[model samples]
Target: MQVLATAGHAAHGKSSLVRALTGMEPKEPGPALTGTAWTRLPSGRRVAFVDVPGDPRSVPAVLAGLAPAPAVLLAVAADEGWMPQSREHLEAAVALGVRSGVLAITRADVADPGIALRQARERLAGTPLAAAEAVAVSTVTGTGTAELAAALDRLTGRLPVPDPDAPVRLWVDHAFTAGRQSVVSGTLGAGTVRVDDELVLMPAGTRVRVRTIGCAGEPRDEVGGVSRVVLTLRDAGPVAPGMALVAPGRWSPTTSVDVRTRFGEASGRLARRMTLHIGAAAVRVGLRPLGPDTARLTLNARLALHVGDTGVLRDPDRRAIAGVSVLDVRPPTLVRRGAGAARARELASWPDRPDGALVLRRHGVLRRAELTGMGCAVPPDAVPLNGDWVADPAHWETLRDRLAAETARHAAERPGAPGLPLETVRLRLGLPARELVAALARPPLRIEGGDQLAGGQPEPEADGLQ
Candidate 1:
């Protein structure tokens, strides 16, 4: 299923449009500032609205939280022309690979509609957005609501679709309390999620019971197909936005990844090391160019990114300039000098043993925390030294014993640290991908205070990170 996101400058009539489109108010209570609102609209239509803060810092969270390949709605006020924040949202959307969208020129009665349209065209010129159509709308007058909804229905076909029989997975973009239980809201990416379906929260993989599923504010038994859903989870714990409530036996967090990213006109040359933001997770990656169409990079920090996940590249200031989609995911060792045999051999021995520094030269499925919990300890190193105590045959037997002991000890003692990134461990071990992963399944040791891991924490609140 596709996760559609609504983003524009503040007060572009997005909240009203969302209500008209889905008939649900994601903007809860009191007066609405519309700061990154997400909801599962009525009729199994899942829409996540990032009501941007109009503040410059909020742009990163809006762009980063966006579901990959989801439909985008660039709402512009007809009377307001192209405001500063509006342009920022537009560029961020374009960077995320949003091609098909319906431009809603709101406040038509209050302002000149044509002027806004012209400004939007100018801002989006030379991009795919220039070719798409627009629908004029007014929340007060109730004008053009039907036309915009129809256009959205047509655009839904382009968003990603998951197998209906596949396990359910959703990025919890919004979480709040309705009454007695914790509720999570986001676009359903795939499969059918129904009332009382048992679910698992990833990294921790804790069991959560489902009490009800609300689609577009109405209680329902089931929902799918680009629909928004608010699920009352039994074991909500500290679950928040960016957390994936996935069907059992379906979710895999990546440690190494092969991604394809496109730089924007304003983007400078992507350097060797940078940070990547996806959903609610962020990590600094060591970037390596493979070709014009491909890239081989390592996450300096850690995350369980997946194949087909959307990620945005940002500068140190946290400003996003480009977005990427994962094409492949493997072990942290895959961040090899080349995607070759030698790299594989070196990374294979990594997991179960201690190391000085681990680097995910590429992004892959294994979660960094789980990987690290496998008895691997990392020494202080700003970069993934790719150091391995087991690399030498003499040290192999000793390291092997340590790996076994660590995995059993940690699995029983700590269970798992959802906060630890698997990438951090892989890079720290500097072991071959195969070895590092095997230990991840049943880690070799327990991890205490993180002395060396970076980018291991998955900050769910994008606003807080800002």
Candidate 2:
């Protein structure tokens, strides 16, 4: 299935265009409860259309549509040209990594769409959507809707398929009870869910069974990601919009995360109060800046998330204020002064390819299984230190340099002293364990008596000095 979210100013014909393109009539009583519409392609492939309200106050809704949809249909009105909501929605889509999109100049019959198309082209220049094609469309007259559909088809073909074997992390957008079962609907982004699969509800950690699965309103035995899914649960606890349904025992919920963000033209530290929108969930949060593009978020409640999830940090008004790429889903707390800088340094040194080197640098040491638990690859050249901890070459060099300088200084201050006490050395270097210090002492330095390091080759143990 292919999904394209429609974003534009209110009354710019987004809903009308969707109805005209999909042939799916809007629910007569009101907008659909999920605020989404669907259609089928000639190839029997399904296409779902999510309409993001153009009102600025509905930024959260807009972000929800942008995050899950592989592509977006940014609508502009021929008569209204480009509006503030249009720019806001486009920026949000880009922030959330929407790379493929089409510019729909709606209501072409009302005015010269040439002007609107030109303005959109100029506005999108140098942005992620700069390459997007502009299609003049009018729902009333049914002009160019077919061409827009073709564009969506081509765009959907370019999206990379999610791994069907990965852990399922469905972001629940809506939940309700039907007959004797509880049903939850969401856009499944990864893995597959089958009937009788035991799933874990995150943040609350409740277990439930999938009695049945539905896709595009039809019953199915199994459903893979990159499609809108509806799961009927055997036992449903207090599930809500912001919670997630994940693979059993594969994920954990956390109240804080560390991330690197791109704030665009908006500058200054993030406001104390902001909202973080990831997938379909939005939560109020506290922001602590670690650097220009780095921060630590303290979420109001825990969320089931991963290390690489893309999130958007919005201002108090819920506008797209910053785009965040999560670095660490479970980060240590900052309790003392200068802790922020220390954390920032760690983030700066975080390896692009998370590996044994990163684990060794971050925690200074780790068990073999701990490295595997973090999904770090053990490099072929990795050298083991102590029992199970691996030593990063760079970190080892830094430790060696510091030890050499400190030892030299200690000997110079107290001429004829054997060496610095191991405990004193540990305290001076802020090392957590004596084992770490012992692991660092190599050639040119010797540890003796289990408590002292020989500063200058042990002075040959002057005869009978005892």
Candidate 3:
């Protein structure tokens, strides 16, 4: 199954287009109706249309609809070629990285769709949807609807294949009680979800089991990525919008993140406070600019975020929106005078994709599992030292040299004392475990006994009298 969201101004036939394509009446516009409508095209491919409201007040709902969708069905009315909400919706789509879609000139029977199509193309120029196919449709006369459907079929066919085995991160756009059970629905961005799979709810960390799975209004044993899904959950306490269900033990819910702007320079110009909209979740955040294109966001609440996650930052006071790409979820604190600028320099060197080696280089050493939990993909060739701990080769060499120098100093300070206690050496070197000290021991530095380390040749034992 494929999913596409409807983005356009209100009363611009967004709902009418959905009704024509899916043959189902859209639910009243709200945060809960993000991905409720579905249809199957002539090519035998199932597609779900998320009809989002275009009201300026409902910008959050529009963001929720576009967050997880891979493509869009951008609607523009012939009579009203382009509008304010149309630009806003298009900006939201570009911010969320939506690249595949169809431009539908709706209500063509009332006016010349040629003008609307040309206007939309002019606005879409240089955006991800710049080359999107356009179809002029008139639901009143049932004209061009078939062509629109065919265009959508082609759009879905061109969508990038999703990884079914990737980690699941389903953003809950709607949650409600069905009879005695709790039901939640959202678009599955990646990975597959099964009936008995256990998932952890983000920001709350509540564990829940999937009692049932439904997709496209039909019950199923499991469903894969890039599809709209409904799950009846057990132990789903306080499930609501803006929360996410992710693979248990695989995500880190963080309150602070470093991001790169997709729209414009964020340095010293954006509001100090803004609301971050990502995957149906919206939360207040404090912004601290790190560079012209980079900034740190301190969210009011924790969010299960990863590297490369895209979202929009809206300044409520000015109603300004900026697209952001998350760079680091576990960002370092900027308490020193020049730390922020130095961090900006560091971030400037980072690639858009997650890099485990880069993470290890920054921290010196980290547990392999901790790195992965931070949404980093640990390289297969990474060598682990002292069990799960992986150290950067250069950092580890520096630590080894420091260890040798510290051991020699300890021996020189106490000529007759047993070489520094293993725990003491570990503490002096700021090593997390004493095992690392042993791992760092070289030819001249060796463990004297089970609990002590010797830095030099051992003193000769006094010969005993016969």
Candidate 4:
């Protein structure tokens, strides 16, 4: 199955194109902005259409539709050529990293599509969709619909296969009651959801069980990525839009994140307060500039955000938008005077792509699971210490030196004492576990009584020193 979101201005024939391609009427019985729709293509491959609103006031809805989709179906009317909403929709898609999609020139029977086609190509230039195939279609006359479907088929074929074994992070776009059960639907970007599988509702951390799964309007035991999914959940006491269902203990809900702008500048030009739109959730945020292009956003509410996730920051007062890519979800505290500038320099050195080794190097040491939870792909060559801890090679060496120094200092200060206690050493070094301290103990410095860290030899008695 494949999912492609519709991006264009309202009344620009986006819904008409969807209706022609799916051969199905609008299920919501109102404007396309009301809800999402799904159907099977002629090739037996199911496709879901997330009809998004093009109005400026509905920018959040537009982002929600584009956030989870891997591709898009961009529409432009032949009579209107190019409109303001068309550019906004295209920018939104680009912001969300949507690459592969087909361009549909609607209302071709009423006006020549040549002008609109050229205009779209000019606007799409230098974007991810620069090479997208265009088809002229008139839903009124049923002309070019077949070609449009064929183009979509080709687009689906080119979409990269998603990892089915990835952790589940289903952003709920719609939630409603059915009979006596609660149902939530969204596009599953990755991972698989199965019946009876336990998932945690993020931010609130409430656990819920999947009673049933529906895909392409059919009941299924399990569903995989790139497919629209509806799950009937049990114990999901007040599920709502903007909430996400995720694998338990695999995600970290954070209220602050560091991001780099991909669209607008993030310097003093941006407002101090803005709205962040990611997946199906929108939250008020406080923006603090770390650099000309980088900033820290403090969200009003906690969100299960990951490194490399793309989102939009909208300043409603200024009617401005900026495309942002997350750099760090758990950034360090900047309580000092020059800390923000120092952090900006550190972020400038980071690669655009997420790297686990970079994270390990920055933090010196971290649990392996914690790195994975941050959406970092741990490098195969990462140095693993005792237990679940992994450390940077250079950082581990530094820790050994620090331990020896601390032990020597303790002996000099308290000559009669056996040595520094292992627990104390762990605390002094800020190590998360005591096993790490034991692992750092070398030949000369050893754990003598299985509890106390001693130097090579015991210190002389106080009277012997006299």
How far does residue 95 in candidate 4 sit from its true spot (Å)? 1.0
Clashing pairs in 3: none
Candidate 1 stretches greater than 4 Å from native: 1-3, 19-24, 28-53, 156-162, 176-181, 265-268, 271-273, 283-304, 316-318, 331-466
Give each model's whole-structure lDDT: 0.59, 0.76, 0.86, 0.84
At residue 458, candidate 3 shows an lDDT of 32
**Over the stretch 1-466, how does candidate 4's per-residue lDDT look in tens digits?**
8889998987898888878877765443212343566766667677888877777788777888888999999999999988988998988888777888999999999999999999999999999999999999999999999899888887887788899999899998878765557788889998999999999987688888999998877899999998888899866787778899999867768999988888866556899999999998889999999988889999999898778888888887776788888888889889999999999999887765568888888888888888888888766776778768888888888887788679778878888888788999999998888888878787667887788888743332368656
- Candidate 2 per-residue lDDT, tens place, 1-466, comes to 7677888888898888888877775331122233667787555667787766777767776787678878888899999998998888888888887888888899999999999988899989988899987888888888888887777767777777888987788887777765557777777877899999998887788888999888766789998878877787866776667678888645547788888885453324668778899888899998888866678889998787656678788885534378887777657779999999888887876633345555556665555545543445555455577766666666667777788888878878888877878898888776667877788776667888999987453222248856
Top candidate on lDDT is 3
Please provide, for model 3 over 1-466, each residue's C-alpha lDDT reduced to its tens digit, 9 standing for 90 to 100.
8889999998999989999999998652234544468889989999988889888888988999899999999999999999999999998999888888999999999999999998999999999899999999999999999999999998888888899988899998888864557788888988999999999988888888999998987899999988888898876777888899999767778999999988843657999989999999999999999988899999999898778889999986787889898888888889999999999999998876568888777777778877877778776656578778888788888887787677667668878888888898888877778888778787667787788888664333358962
Candidates sorted on lDDT, descending: 3, 4, 2, 1
TM-score-wise, the better of 2 and 3 is: 3
Compared with the true structure, the alpha-carbon lDDT of candidate 1 equals 0.59
User: Of models 2 and 3, which has the larger lDDT?
Assistant: 3
How many backbone overlaps does candidate 1 show? 57
**Model 1: per-residue lDDT, tens digit, 1-466?**
3455676787788777877765555553223233333433233554555443455656545754454436677789997888877876776777666777778999987988999998888887898788767989998888888788676766665555666765566766567654456877666656788887888875466778888887644788888745666678764677655567766645455556666665452222676677776665556787765545356667654444445556677675545466676655553344445564454344334332223244222222223343333212233322221233223233343434544444445445655544234454455444446435333322223344433222222223257656
